[model samples]
Target: MTFNIAFSEVTVTIGNVSVDGYTEDIVVPITVSNPNESVGGFQFDVITMPTIINISDVSSVNENDFSADFNIFDDGTARVVFYSNTGEGIPAGSDEVVLNLHYNGMDVLSALVDLEGFNLTVSDADGDVIAGNIVDGSVTIGNVVFFSSDIPDTGDVLEQVSVDISIQNSGLVGGVQFDMYDTPNYLDVINLTTTTRTEGFQIDFNELDNGATRVLLYSPDNQNIASGSGPIANMEMVVHDNAYNSNVGVNFENITITDDIGGSYWVAGVDSGTVTVTPGYIEEPHNLQAQDGMDAQVLLSWDPPYGPIPSDFSEDFEEGVLPEDWITTTNSAQGWFITQDGSSAFWTVPSHTWYMCSNDDMADDDGSVDYLITPGLNVSGAQNITLNFASYYDGAYGQTAHVLVSTDGVNFTEVVTLEPSPEWVMETVDLSEFAGLPNLHVVFHSNDNGAWASGWAVDDVFITFAAREIDRLVHYELTELGQWALTAPKDEVMSRFGGGLPHNLKVDLSQPFLTENRPVELDAFKVYRSLNSSTGFQEIAEVGANTTSYLDEDVVNSTTYYYYVTAIYPDGSESGPTGTVSATPVEW
Candidate 1:
């Protein structure tokens, strides 16, 4: 049997309200008709922003045949249910008052009070799904307000990006609802913070469909905002490295404001913004900081907190092809060529890619010097520069490899000289004395002076700043299962389960370093655990790279343990241990 349930009118007139000491009554009448059988029960939710209105009571008009109750949830939706009390039910074609909703004006706001009729139902004295058309109602509350913007038009990749949301001439507001949007694949929202008058209230943010995010802010005590301007919220986002040379769009949708006097305000228009991510050699300039110093101290450092360092620049040439920008020159026919060498067989230490130069590839040495120079590195404004690489040489005819640095790439300065070695030797050169230069060119010169030169092989070339402290936090908690879990992102409390427990420290290596769309690659991760806070830490386990988290299960009840993780690179370079985190296992 087909049954139709709908509101009596399109919009129940809620005329007007004063700003202070206001009280008003709003009645919403629900009707039912076209019933193929007797109607026994019905249910629906009155959805509206609580900051705008207060639902004091919801009683049925036909109390002789049915009784009703109203319940409100924290999300501001009121659920109303009415069921038949008498033995007989309302017959078909009977259209009378089924519900009388009572609302009090709490705020002067503007929005649609909706009757979500999806759960609306009618039964023939027996509980059954009734098939019919459920026409919902949309009731407008107040007047139209506006949402404005003052965001920048463009930004650079890896640059700090932020946007602001402002309310235009809004007064005595208690709550707001809006949708925020950004370039789907190019921009990532990292963090959001409240601003101005809204900072005094609580906010809820959730991700929506099609790369949109929703934000709702309301007074904790249901108080009204008297006056405010500027930004209401600040959103921090990042432009992906792959977005170089492209622009990302930012906009808002479905915005509304609610005053404390039971009135709602619709946003007149949404002001949009855009950010253009440009290509650059460096993500951003180093955040240099000054330190207190004594006489002739030169107390400049690249540590974090006060000073932060930039990501390293590295190249392995694993593709078996030299980068087009890399420089290669030779006074003779035989130059540096990437080839398989018996002396440089191992892949882990230096990398999978290696380059070699020797007289064996030429008919005669001719006392020629071959050069393999790297492309210009943008280490401008950087301090304490360093270079690391692996080389293998046989020392035939006293042939040596010379490492040189250049500012103009044409005029070279000899930095270090390497003797012949039968096995691969890792080298570290301190380029700190030459810091503060804009363009840095590193060159490897191999000399074969008309003599039998065995070979010169180099691999895993990397240029990085000095190691800095790792960021981390630790926590201890008692769980329901009575076991302690060591979480990377520190938390106050934790929960545990039976034997197969989860204790993975989730890591998000989502940001790119140099390669397009490719994240920084690590060979492995070493987790260190310590029982005594003042003593040494021992390696507990080692996991492979790209593994986001780790599970550490070994612990004794009532004992406290600390943990930290270090990333291992293919060139045998290890990152500084992350900040230590602690957890105590206790049975409750």
Candidate 2:
């Protein structure tokens, strides 16, 4: 019996694997080194924990003259027996594959495969015992749960910032622990709180190495609880007073969770978050200084304007008297003047008055040209300049208003021509191409070419520098994909289409607001509608941030509806409403 074998090796090809929900299959191979003798048969008992893996199939690799038969017993063990089928036995002094085993994952855990040396036997062609050493292999099949969430991007200095942790999946678990680390230059974690707790699980944490590193842990003392997906913890930090960067890095490192059973598992992935430190709001008083004459050589000085102005600026003409900052041409007779409560001889609505009007006294100056220019605006540091204004014009078609712009009041360029409308209409003009000019001017020059029916009445003028481009999100009833690429919202003001329900209309919605910036994500959009343009604007719907549109099936036929959108932020703040659009429902 000179059967001296080199080694017996059992190897599982892959390392740790994550099981999604159900069981998965794995293949294991066993090989052996032979001695200077022919081999005839071999027998081994495969053992594994019943809660980890179950032997499903066992078979020989089918050598030239060998066959195998295996029987899985109730005791979580398998007996595999191999013998020479044909007369010729396997040659010696070579490494050969002895068997291929198939295993089924049982629970969410790691399983080991071992060959019991006491019950294992090897024989030659003469049915005599042979010698060999045994080796084992293992496979880990389980889920490594973790949290994936976002935090607000922009935060004021000293503002409270909090981040949450959540589990990705469900399993019987003991506890979870992780170390949070980051450069303390932006913010300091002042407190750690548990949002969720397992039954009988105790929570503990300690500062590590430096104050910037924190270790958090939670586990049950005597028993385990079924753990599932939800918030597990929250870390609150205060923004540093001196933090003045565009972005700060915050990360959760070395996150791990333990099973209620035997071993612990690490998170499969992690999504890091960032915090942006923005300057605090500095209020500067609004001073109505006397406007300089429209002489280009005057070089009007913008005396100590208020602190950092918003990207978008607006004036609704609510102030009965025109601001002195607005410059007027020498010919004041034909220039613009603010009128309130039917004060002007021209048109005025009780519900919506307070507008600047070109003198409707046609007898005073027929065919007269009047120019009303805005205060010198600082657009040198902005992008996407836009001008929006509401106007009422019922004069002859040729008797119109021309919107003009100038960097120097001396040289002006025409941007748009407005036609006469019996009712008030809101209009937007793109001034993006002319941005970055320091001394920018928006001028409304009116030409009374024909019969002055009601002259030009303007209100709600918004001259926005670096006009924040509306980031659009649209929702549809039937879309091919759930989420689509980002796009700028459609800028259609007061558009009427045919579609609405008998009671409420299922209106498709699209908005131009962003929801990505953390901490201040766009939460929702408040929808407003009016029966007529001049009156009755009421909130009709509230849609989520991720949703693009809403179906307003609450309406009646033959009734016209005007719609507007206001973006709501996380801090209960709201952006100005979008220009109103109209929709009317009709019976088929």
Candidate 3:
């Protein structure tokens, strides 16, 4: 006997999914609805764009009711077959997922998942074809938000640094907002600005009471940013002076992006970065020792270490005229000239009272080009060459400035472009590429491109470099106790200490021995003392870098105190502590 059953039409659908471009092994489900009879078997081919995504596998959602198998083709097709092994059927239900299609993303794009490529078939328990409606779906790849810093590992304290917040493989975006957080003791946010990619957008930021900086960027005209990879905003910050020998992290939270029509975008992932603060290029004192003296005094001695040397070509523009050998070439009447006046209404004052000025506001013509050239420099044996200067520019009418270098003073190569700064700011340009050139010349060029713009002013120009060793040294005569210990005559030392009677303690000192001949200019020396050998050290006194010894009268008799010394650079960076030495003082 056979029982006849009436089966309603079934609707089959491929579910849509959104994932990140870096995602792998994504699962999309195929669902069934409005089926009156039990479903026995089904077969279909899932197809997609070959370059956007590829099918990996297909699995049955209801494993006990059905078994599934799939074959992936090279043309971005997956043939899926599902059937019941025990001759039983899956009881039809409302919106039931039968099979899942797994895929891997090949690129950042959108692709249609179509089911019309192959013959889609469905059968009932009586081996009869079931009429059904098939629906297609889609897959969308999303964007990745991350952070990057120019200072990858380490930066000096009080140095200005920048961190970039970027989006990768992005879609068309209309607006973005996020909150950034960092240790307040480590870094201080100065300002937020737009990059070249988002220069047309308006940007603003607010510092919350909870130490979070909230930033927002959007176009007033509802314009969208096309798909690309770049920094949307740049964060300018200054490292705190107390952040030395520490790692500081910058993080993002509550990130959101919107399309032109106010739809939310899917974010794939987010990443953060950190910077370490370190004492740069300074050396610590060496061979520190202490000895007991009569009348309960502790005598300390150490060798001073080297520090960063001063530049040879430093000009403050205080002579009221251009130095000899300096040249100026201009197409305008008002070219480069020295001035101490700051009464101009168009341009700001220079860093110092006297500075070089290229006044476009005082020019007669519309377009002006001016060049200030330096004298021939001899940097044949220098390393880490750099050019630093203080500048004030008013770019109200689109004036431009640049720093260039040349070997013949005729053919110049651009080293860096200067940005508009209404106030006085320091600019640094790396010149290591032209380090070995014997006759290198530097040029400061300014242009007002057919516009009545303000002017540019510069002061305190310096061209610094490092060499193998110091060429000259300043001699010190016997003045202080520290100098007398290192430079006193033999007879003078005997007259002070040779007698057996009670006398002041004498600590002999020597100059620092250099393993490698890299000589830096010294600033000062710091002395630290502790009761223990390894910890609890406090700064006792500071002396000149040339001074080699110190007399500590603030000590207890017959008590041992450990001491160490460190060198301080001109930039306020301190070296690591030297080896510890012990001393005991007593009354004779």
Candidate 1 per-residue C-alpha lDDT over 287-384 given as tens digits, one digit per residue, 9 for 90 to 100: 11111111211111111121123338776555567766788777666677775332221111111223444443233454356788888877767787
Candidate 2: where is the Cα deviation over 4 Å? 1-159, 164-311, 330-334, 341-351, 361-364, 395-397, 450-453, 467-588
lDDT of 1: 0.56
Each prediction's Cα lDDT score? 0.56, 0.55, 0.67
Order candidates by TM-score, high to low. 2, 1, 3
Sorted on lDDT, best first, the list reads 3, 1, 2
- Among the numbered candidates, top lDDT falls to 3
Runs of candidate 1 exceeding 4 Å displacement = 1-24, 45-54, 62-66, 73-77, 84-88, 94-97, 112-118, 125-136, 145-248, 253-380, 383-441, 445-588
Which of 1 and 3 is ahead in TM-score?
A: 1
Error of 3 at 548 (Å): 23
Clashes of 2: 19
Q: Model 3, 1-588: lDDT tens per residue?
A: 643434468777888777765567777888877547677887887777434567777788778768899887777577888888767777767568888887876543333333333567777777777776678776665543333343344577788877787876456788888888874357778898887878789988898898888998999888777778777778888886545354678877887877666766655456775766666345675445454434677666554553343567878677889988888888887788887643243333322346798877567364356888899998899877878776765354457788988888788888887876434455677788888889999999877777665567877687888532322221112225533432344345446645322324221223322223324456678899899978899998988766766778898998888888887776677888876667777767
- lDDT score, candidate 2, position 170: 54
lDDT for position 426 in model 1: 49
